[model samples]
Target chain A: MAHDTTIQTAGHDEHHHESPVVFGFWVYLMTDCIIFGTLFATFAVLRNQFNGGPNGHQLFEIGGLALETALLLISSITYGFGMIAAHKNEINKVIVWLGITFLLGLGFVGLEVKEFIGLIHEGAGPDRSAFLSAFFTLVSTHGLHVSFGLLWILTLMVQLAGTKTIPERMMSKLTCLSLFWHFLDIVWICVFTYVYLASMI
Target chain B: MSEHNTTSSGESHGSVSSYIIGFVLAVILTVLSFAIVVTHSLSPSATILTLSLLAIIQVVVHLHYFLHMGGHSEHRWNNICFVFTIGFVSIVIIGTLFVMNNAAVQMMSR
Candidate 1:
């Protein structure tokens, strides 16, 4: 009986010591990177195929993009704060920071949706040209990721609300979400640079 | 509070100062990119090159500060996987651009 308990204890120790869960999630995110990379490539190839329609210089508004970048960047930092709070097991603080992050993320998606609507109204719809199609696909794909992230944040908050102390399981889950959020911000940097900034040039 | 603080010392999760520093640097890089384009200070090729460089730097900042993938031992596989993905991603983007641009040029010339 004593031997059995020792073996079981050892198994528990091994479980908590090695964080394959987080590592596995990281690998998943790397796969996401490849997906974004292919989308970017597609955009680059078709960016100039405007089909006698307005080009990027006419379509992209640097001011609006600057605002969107600001929103996303700030949200990334807020999510980092939430992660820090989660590490301390300060559940309330974690929820608060994440709440702020959610709002910022919402603002980002809202702006993106508005921009898409405006573009369509201006006859820059995806069906108008190959350039428009690629542009809408790439940008909207990022926006969709952000929207999914917001949903994830809400789900995590609901989970956290049920616990007074953050468990190891929850912490690992939050870490994965944190990585996802920061990864999206990095991808946005590329999007703004390659899609908007490069277009102006 | 004491119970929570005890476990915090061992974790690799960074401090507030690191996050703040990363945010400031990112903001500066972002503003600089916009300024370069707005002012048209550099030649067209130079502007694009500078914008790309700034973007790359911001990505590194996010990786290190935000994602916590700095050269720590725990991030070994993560870093390896990231570098590996970047290699393939670079190949795909650059290759597609090269082939497509060349084909377009050839076809247009004909």
Candidate 2:
């Protein structure tokens, strides 16, 4: 039981913990990073492969992307706040901060879905050209990550709400989820800069 | 271990100032990248270079400030993993682009 607690109990130090869970989660995130790397590389190749359809310059709207960028970046900070709250074992504050993070995430995804639907309606759907396909795949994969993150946050909230004490389990989960949220933002920086801005210029 | 003591003392939670600094730096870099593009202030190559440079900096900022990836002794392995991931990711991206673009040029020319 002592070994089990040491192994499975939650951690607040996050990156400082010796538990395999944190290390394993970090490895998982790196693998996920490789996945994004491959996607970005694919986008790089096909970016100019418009095949007579509209290119990114004609299709991407900077205003929406800029807003989306702001929302996600802000949410990253908000999640940081949530993590800090978790570290202090301030459950209510953690909930409030994470709830705020969730809303920002939802807003960002709303804008992304709007962007995709708007593109498809304009006949610039993913199937229209290689460029569009790659763009859609890369951006939507990031968006899917955001969607999953929101779901994860929601579950964490539910679990935390019921628990009287802030369990190490909940903290570990929060730490991993926070790492993931920040990772997505880092990827978004690349996507917006390379995929959207680079395409434009 | 000293690392365990420091973390147990709650020093590892990362200061609010750090998060604020990271947030501000990230927003500035993001806006700067977009501004360069929207204004067309630089040549195409320069714009791409600047954006790429800023993107790299922003990722580092997130890792440092938000992710608590400071050079803590206990986080030595996580730091190594991060470095390795960056290396791997760069190789994949650069290699893919190199191979595909070369093949693409030949195919198009032929």
Candidate 3:
């Protein structure tokens, strides 16, 4: 098939250029930025509307957020390493780095779920106040994205394991996922700063 | 996508050093933002300003090292689209805040 030859060319060629597919992915990410920006605006507007409920300073645990931040940041770099390995045509190393990235991402989502459950148990659920509603909507949206990214990493790992060589289509897919994974980390930085740290101060 | 391969070369994929640099800088900024709040080393306004500045810087760093977006010809369209989107996003966020906060102020005063 023509597809098979394209994959062979992409696999064997050095300094292969990214196809238009990557730019298309970037366009999608840009729209995602708008979605997050609107959410951030909503959170900003409602942050002070505690409705007689506990505020962020009282509800957020800095240590836990720091741990989540560390997990996510580390995972971003590990995914970068995976991309580098992919470029070097080391399929096994790429899979290994991706596996590590998956675990770290899972850890991040786990801590987020724990925090959400704990908050709900303590009556700080989204229903409690406008502030909490905005908080839950904004933060959980990011959490959901991470969960999806974890699923993506898993799917890719399974696909990579079955193949001896990364096909052109596969490499492009990996590149898009790498961008997404790093993009999430970037969003988390904003979340940590504005939502958590700013609230603390 | 196939047309793109024939027309343009790919952007830089990033190196290990670039990744490490981005990670270290991100960690530093994160710790600094957290520390500024925890230690209460600055006034409230100053802390917010500093955190916002740090976050912006960290974002740029990630865009550069991780995303491999740069101010080069190869990335011209990507940069243009990014700036265009960011402009609209700023309008959305800042405009909403300005209007809503003003409305809140007026309503609360009564």
Candidate 4:
């Protein structure tokens, strides 16, 4: 469904053309951003409402979170590398970099699940207090996105591997995924500072 | 997003140096926020404000470098979407805080 404006502009430019689908993806991403923003606000309001339960300073392990943060941050750039490879139409390099990105993303989700389970085991489950509920909801929502991103990476990899050449449809999806992955990194930056770092200091 | 972005023959490519620069800046920003929090080297309010400011800066850096959010060729929608998102985000966040905080005060005082 190429818009008339898209074709005319794309033809005139001779290079640096973009499909209209990315605009739709941008709209999708903004809605996602709104959801996250609301979640952050919810967390902010409830962060101090421990209700005689353990608070962030007690539950947050800054060291572990920092490591998790590093993994996700690095993974975003690794996915960026995959995007570059995808553009260059290099199947092997794209697979290698995307494989690395998948590992890092998988590692991030693992650490998050481990931390959530650990907290639950210690009687600090979401039901423990308002603060705990907000914390779990916000962080787990992020983890869920990462999990989905992992699936997207796998699907793209399998598709690329079978096709033996990069297709435009797959490339568009890859570009959107690249944007999604990087957007998640930015959100994680906020979580690391506003939630974890603020609670600690 | 990459610092040096080029598209020819209907393919988009980014420079290695661009990715490296964004990565290094992000890492540095993350470490700085951590160090400031762990060390307790400033007043509590100052620390929070400083960390928040740094986070905002890092967001901008990622948008510019990694997301390529600027006015790229044939990408007017990207900029428009960014402005729209920011407006909506500010409203959602600020509105939530204002309403929730007020409700808490009224309920608790009663």
Best by lDDT: 3
Interface RMSD of each: 7.5, 6.0, 5.4, 5.7
lDDT for model 3: 0.87
Q: In the order shown, what is each candidate's alpha-carbon RMSD?
A: 7.0, 5.7, 5.7, 5.4
Output the TM-score of candidate 2: 0.90
- In model 3 chain B, which range of ten residues has the least summed lDDT? B1-10
Model 1, global lDDT: 0.85
> How much lDDT does candidate 2 score?
0.83
In candidate 3 chain A, where is summed lDDT lowest over 10 consecutive residues?
A: A1-10
- Tens digits of per-residue lDDT, candidate 2, A1-201, equal 222232223254444454567778999999999999999999988887778899889888899999999999999999987876676677899999999999999999999999899999999999999989999999999999999999999999988895667766666788789889998998898899889999899
**Candidate whose TM-score is highest:** 3
- Give the C-alpha lDDT of model 4: 0.83
Higher-scoring candidate on DockQ, 1 or 3? 3
Q: After superposition, how far is residue B104 of candidate 3 from its true place, in Å?
A: 1.8
Q: Worst lDDT window (10 residues) for model 4 chain A?
A: A1-10
* Model 1's TM-score against the true structure: 0.90
**What TM-score against the true chain A does chain A of each candidate get?**
0.91, 0.91, 0.93, 0.91
Quality of candidate 4's docking, in CAPRI categories?
Answer: medium
- Which pairs of residues have clashing backbones in candidate 2? A10-A168
Question: DockQ for all models, in order?
Answer: 0.43, 0.49, 0.48, 0.49
Q: In model 4, how large is the Cα lDDT of residue A193?
A: 88
